[model samples]
Target chain A: MEQILANGVYLGAQYAMIALGLTLIFALMNVLNFAHGQMYVLGGFVTYTFYGQLGFPFVAGLVMSCVTLFILGALIERFLFAPVIRRSSRDESTMLLAAGLAFFFDAVILLLFGEKQRGVPKIVNGVFNWDFRLIMPYDRILICVLAILSIVSFILFMQYSKTGRALRALAQDRTAAQLMGVNVDRYSMIGFALGAMLAGLVGGLLVTITGVNLGMGGPTSIKAFMMVMIGGAGVISGAIAGGIILGFLEAIGLAVLSQYGDITYLMIFVSLMIFLAIRPQGLMGKPWG
Target chain B: MKRRVVLKSAVAAVALSAFAAGGAWAENPVLKIGFVGVTSGPAAAWGISNQRSMETRAAWINETGGYTIGDTTYDIEIVSFDDQKDPKRAIAGMEKMAQEGIHYVVGPNVDDGAAAVRPVAEANGIMYFPYAFPKELYTAPASNAVLGMVANYQSGPAIYKYLMENKGVKTVAFIAANESDPLSQRDGGVAAAKELGLEVVSDNVTYQVDTTDFTPVLTPVLRTRPDLLVLSGVSPANAPQLIRSARELGYQGLISTETAQDAQVLQEGAGDLANGFISVGGASTPELASDAMREFVKRYTDMFGEYNDESNTKVYALEYILETLKANPAAIDDVNAFQATMDGFEAPNPYMVGDAKLRYVGSTSFGQKRQVAVPLVVNVYQDGAFETLFVAEVD
Candidate 1:
């Protein structure tokens, strides 16, 4: 039970970090940001180059990932999203653009990084075993703590900072925020960049453990969607709750269903479907089109 | 009168140039071979290795005045398609090869891709050597796909017997990626292990191919305390993570797989934790590698900026195709003729030093000469390289 809990907590922390960025972008831009996962992959490669290849300190590599993704996000929002959203009439048009961007990022990543599985040296070593009941690696524990810290930092920033206040108002009501002199274009760009930075931060952190590849982008986005759906799309608290819930369910399912074999994931998916059928709005989401 | 003289002089010039070259032909013809497989996604290494090996050998042969069969010396050209690991795309790739009028091809590296392209290969009279291991692909009523490497069943029993006799292994466990290819391999490994009189303590453990953290998936298998853990049909990308997870879980038993792995990947992904890991490797070891094999590796490295160990096995498919065509030039355009030639086909293996021979086997396993008879070279991962564990033959 202890081992399962530890696994759940660790998995939840990382999953929540991944969902946070996707949810943030959706809330700010009202665009699904399908390339969010590719942005995450770009972050991982940046860190892989800086830390794994260039012998930089791990912290520096992580910071570099954030800075790089942040700039990229701002540029993408200004050049790609803003122009398309302006000219397009239908919401699905943005979805198409987002999907196209996903393919573009996938191609760019494959060209730049190649298809080899890459990893970094463990930042810390040794196992954290408590009588074989609650076993965890120190690297995992450090990453979990760091992810939680980053999440808290993000919440504080959104709650207190002037830019964060402006972004929240924009997300709440774009026209009202614009009338209030929030600089809609600039604040929207900042919010998108912030969201992308979170993705980069998680990607940079998890690259040490899971490592990243071009193929991971699609699945990561899908998993992030599951979390958002479970918690409620475009809701930050919903994303975190959804992440933790899915994480615990996977941990428990794997632990209990070992005797039954590969059907654990199938059973989990079925249960989720049943839950969604009963409550389509998810745990905390309001009805939306 | 002037036009007639010009034409006469042009004909004489052609004849004189051909006669001067001491040949009856103007220039050599080109034989195009096709490669269809994943060379872009996560599993890119597998097909990339296959494509690179073919390209390297083709370059070498072309550089050395082309390959002569019967009355003609022909240039080797590789036509490749990146299926991106999708079966539907693999079918399209096969169709493209047929459209190009290629008779012999290599690849579609995974099980589904191989299986998917079979009908196209048969209908189009194209012979494809695939790196997949489903027995039905080589059995009766199916003839186009030739097994490119040693199957898990063959390597599994061999490893199990060696361990049971030498390392005292009694109980074993199996884990796979929950995909069709790996699951099929797990079943084969399970059967092979059982036939060898070893107990399969656990065999149902599986994880998604995209799984990053394997602790949850491996914990129950570890609890069973099997002496041997077989990762069935594992890809190069996922092998090290599984090994690292098992070791970090304090598994003191032996870990093995039945697929070629990249040493650099293992080193990067698992570091020292990958030491003592066992796997089926490319058919040649350092001791077994001929000078030609060494040169091929050097050229492959030079051409691609790096070399993949899997290419050691991949290098043989195109050679087999060309040599078989040379044996009976009729097979160049007729695949049925190629199938007829297989039962009695024999050639000297160029990759090895000694009296190693290249031919088709699988009469015992599949009741046909539908498998490549490459020497099975078992490898154990050490610091940053795969040291030879043992070498065996498939009969």
Candidate 2:
């Protein structure tokens, strides 16, 4: 049980980091950024380029990845999302636009990088002995700490910082906040850049554990959508709570039913269905305003 | 004077035409061969290396006055494609090759690539050679166009038999990727273990291709407390993660697999965790003392600047095909004649396993015995490098 918990915590941290970006984007733009996963994949490629190709330090590579993805996210919002949101046709238009952008980005990435998983150098090496006969890697622990820090810092930023508060107001009521002289367009772009940066950070962390491949972006995007839906769409706290719960459930479920052939996906789907039936608005979630 | 001038001009034109025809006939025919692989992914190392090795061998053949078929010598020209390890791409590549009239082609290295190209090759009457071990290729109703250089499903049983006899392994757990190819290889391993009277404790497969977090899978396998851990069809990316994770989890059990045996795989992918793992392959390490092996290695490194892999079985088989065709040019004209020549032909094991014989089993399937030998090289990772433990003929 302890072993399962240790594993679950590590896996859950990664999910939380990835989902935080999706949730943040949702709050700011009122549009689900499906292309969030492509940003994650791009983050991994940037890390690979800096560390593997340029021979930079692992941490430096990670920072470069974050910065690059932040700029890319801002650019995406400026060109792609801004035009669609300006028209304000319907919610479906936003979703369709986001989905189209996601496909386009993924296709571009595939064309450039080809379909291969590339490995990044491990940042930290060594194992941690928790108790008698229980050992885990320090990298996983670092990831958990980083996830916690990012989430806390994000919450604090939204509550205290001037720009973050403006972003939140814009998220809550775009038209009302705009009338109050909060630059709605600028905040929306900032929100996307922030979300992309967070997602990129998670990608860099994930590279320490697994390889970065072109196929990863699609799955990451799907998981992020599931996390956001489970946490209640556009709810900040809900995304975090939902991410952690889903991550833990997946990890523990995989551990328990490891003997069964090809049951992981089925188990996760069934669990999600049950959760949806039990709490329509999610565990810690309220209906979207 | 006008008639004389016209006759002279006509004679000059005829002479020019005759010279052109002579030049065309004199120049060696470029025999086009196709090579297919996933030239773009994490598994790119294997694909790249396979291409390099084939090119090296082709260069060597061309340099030696090319392949002699009867009175004609043909220059070998390889047409390579990046299949990306996608079955659709593989099929498309094979179809393109067939349309372009390539008679002999090598590769589509993995099982899925082979599966894609096999039917197309059979339908088009084009010969295809692949370097993956999947039992289904050998067991099914055979086709004439496909030839698999690696040993068949029987090799797994041979491996298990050897382990039970030598290593004293009683209980084993199988870890494999949850894909069709890996699943098939795992099934073969499981069947072999069962036949050898060994206890199979657990079989775990990961659905995700880039699974780094193996604790969910490995913890349960470790709990079973098996003496040996068998990995089936592990890709280059996942092999290191599994090894590292297992090591981190303090699994001291003997690890063995054929998939992670490539030298490049160990150096680039596995790193330190690769130490002490054992794997099987179709070729032995090149001995510097042997002129052929040394020259081949040197030329390969000179051309490509590194050892792409140590699998010389494909190269040797390819060379064997050339040699067979040379000895009997009539065989080149017909598939049956070619198979007959391949079956009858024997050469000194180019892989240098000692008295190992190469004979093509007459099967139409691409994996059919192009060459017959129990040429399995067992390599152990020692002192941060792969060293051959034993080269036994697995019957």
Candidate 3:
């Protein structure tokens, strides 16, 4: 049981990282960026090239991955999403566009990297043990700590910072904020960029844990969607709770059921249905207007 | 009237010349051989290795004016399809090959893909040389199927004996990916371990092929504290991750595997952690090479920049096919005769990997004539190189 919980906690940490970024985008944009997972994949590949292949410092690789995604995400918002945002059914159109971009990213990565799995070497090695049992790796511990710290920092910034306040104002009421002298376009682009940067940081963390492969994008995107939905769409705190729930369910299920661990997805879907039937607003989310 | 007669005669002469030219074209033809496998997915390395061997050999043969059968010689044209390691895609590739009238095929490397592809090839009367380890795919229903690689039945026992006698391994824990070949390997491995008097302390553990974190699977097995861990038929992409995870979890047991034949991948993925790991593959180093093997390694390295064990096996397959065709020319036109010839065929070249001569054998599960009894080499990774510890001869 201890082993299961330890593994579950680690899995939960990674899921929360991905879910946090995805939820932020939904909260600010009101658009489900289906390409969010592809951003994660691209970020990991960038880290792999920088730290794994080019022999750069791991911290440098992570920072560079964040910066690259920030710029790229801003450019995508400006060129692709800007013109489409004026439409009446912008949400559906943007979602479709995100899906198309996801496939396009996969194709481009496949062309460049070929379809082999690439790994980022562990920054720190060795295991921590309790007597003859309960062995946990230091790298996994580092992942959890880093993820929590990053999430908390982002939340604090959103609460206190001026730019973050502007972003939150736009998320709360875009038209009203615009009327009150908030630059709607700049805040929207920055919000998307911030979300992309978070996704990229999570990618760098995970590449060392699971290794990076091209096919990771599709499954990961689906998992992100599940996390967001289960937590209530457009709710940051809900995303965290939902991610941990799903992660623990998977890890504990695998520990007990072994080969039938995939049934956890079905269980999560059932839970989603129950949540919708009862408290559709989710644990930390307000009821939809 | 005289001018009209001359013109008619000239027209008839030109028509006669065209007919004669068409008749000459019928004497020599291009023989289309198809290769279907996972050429562009996570398992792409396996398919790419086979592709390198087939394409390199085909190029050499073409350069030398092709394979000669009696008085006529035919150029071998290789048509490749990437199945992406999926069964449905493999079947689709087979359908496409059938439409194109390709008579010979190289592989559908994975067991599930092989199962789907075999029937299609059999139904189309195309002779297929598969790289899979499954038994039933080579049976009566799929008479055209020929296994060019070693099966788990032979490898499982061979590995067990090596670990027991050579390494003095007494207890083992078995793990496999949840795929046709890996599952079959686990079944074979467990039975072999029991037969060899080695106690299996842990139950057979299985994980999905795409499983990233093996902690959930490996944690319980580590608690058993078995003397050895056997990863049977794990994909090349997953093996290193599982191995690293096991080591990191503080399981100080001897590790053995029967998959991921590429040494470069093992080294790159697991780093120094892979040292002392026992597996069933080796590079074509100088000492292990015969004259022909040396030539093959040199040519292959020149063409592709590196030589791995899969490259050698696939090359052996191409050699076997070419030699078989040269000996029995009629088999080129008649796939039934080709299948019969392959059923009883022995290695005509000095391709020494196993003990004695390499040949096809019958299986009770498949209940038909199939599978080559290739030598299973017990290789140990030490000091960044694979050293052959033992060669289990096939009887």
Local distance difference test scores for all models: 0.89, 0.72, 0.77
Give residue A104's error in model 2 in angstroms. Answer: 9.2
Q: In every candidate, what fraction of the native interface contacts is reproduced? A: 0.56, 0.44, 0.36
Question: What is the lDDT for A251 in model 2?
Answer: 78
For residue A159, model 1's alpha carbon misses the true position, in angstroms, by 1.3
Segments of candidate 3 deviating more than 4 angstroms: A28-35, A78-103, A169-189, A259-289, B1-30, B56-77, B282-286, B290-309, B344-369, B372-374
Interface RMSD of each: 1.4, 3.5, 2.8
**Cα DockQ of the candidate 2 complex:** 0.27
lDDT of 1 by residue, A144-194 (tens): 999999999989998999998998898888899999988999998999899
What lDDT tens digits, residue by residue, belong to model 3 across residues B123-241? 88777788787666776666877787666676677877777787789999988876677887888888888988999987556776667778777876777899999988877678778
lDDT of 3 at A140: 82
Q: What residue pairs clash in candidate 3, if any at all?
A: B354-B375
lDDT of 1 at B386: 94
How big is the positional error of residue A238 in model 1, measured in Å on the Cα after superposition? Answer: 1.3
* Most accurate candidate by lDDT: 1
How many angstroms is residue B270 displaced in model 1 relative to the true structure, after the best TM-score fit?
0.7
Instruction: State the displacement of the C-alpha of residue A203, model 2, in Å, after optimal TM-score superposition.
Output: 2.6
User: A-chain TM-score per prediction?
Assistant: 0.97, 0.93, 0.94
